[model samples]
Target: MINASGVLRTPRQTLFWRVTNCAGAQDSARIFRVEKYFSPYTPIKSRKSMNKGEFVESLADRLDVSRAQADRALSAVLDIVAEQLAKGEKIAFTGFGSFEVSKRAARTGRNPQTGATIEIAASSVPKFTAGATLKAAVNGK
Candidate 1:
């Protein structure tokens, strides 16, 4: 990277290295034409979110199994987790995470539109706590 003529410049470079030519004189500092390539169309991957279908596809590809089989397996796993959670049972996957039901106490909330107080009923919601391995994986370990 070089700044010249009040312009921020990036030398033409590949992912790992850049190309620069030193003039005939070895003593001279290399004068490299700094040209940055910025493509507006280059896709910026903000996040890799896997939907249910994409997840099934990934599972199928990884397991070398049919899509239907993968889908069924995913469905079964989800169903079992839901069943266990509904029964107030916690499911823990060693080093992965734990899934359980969290209960929210009933409360009163103000309605924004009417400025009126409303009663919010208590409810149970599914919750997941990431385990050590899962946290490590997310942190790029």
Candidate 2:
């Protein structure tokens, strides 16, 4: 069982790594390392914000591409995404998620403490809906 604040009270199962074979006379055949697998209900940490330059460098390292090429590719892809969203279109990537623009209706809101009435303007904002696979992985299913 786990609490709302992410503290585990009881675990249903535990895992361990075991050595299966020994190729040499000096090699040890039996070694175990315990591993705790989080339950499906565990909460995940949110990702930190990354600027374009940092994103490019990370992608370059992961994809084995030059930083310049990664920058260009990343910029182009982001531009395309922004352009599609600007045109009120939804972009879907398999195993990832869907990005779409949602419209918020204008409404009256109050200023806290001051109790002043304020007019909130209607606006369109981008939203993401995670795909099933990604959602499952996040939930540790």
Q: Worst lDDT window (10 residues) for model 2?
A: 10-19
Give one digit per residue, the lDDT tens place, for model 1 in 38-57: 44443435335658998999
Which segments of model 2 are wrong by more than 4 Å? 1-51
Query: What is candidate 2's lDDT per residue for 1-141, written digit by digit as tens?
Result: 544544455333322233344444444545444434445554324324567787898899899999999989988999999999999999999988999999999999999999999999999999999999899998889
Q: Give the TM-score of candidate 2.
A: 0.61
- TM-scores of all candidate predictions against the true structure: 0.67, 0.61
Q: What is the Cα-based lDDT of residue 70 in candidate 1?
A: 100
TM-score quality measure for candidate 1: 0.67
lDDT of 1 at 99: 94
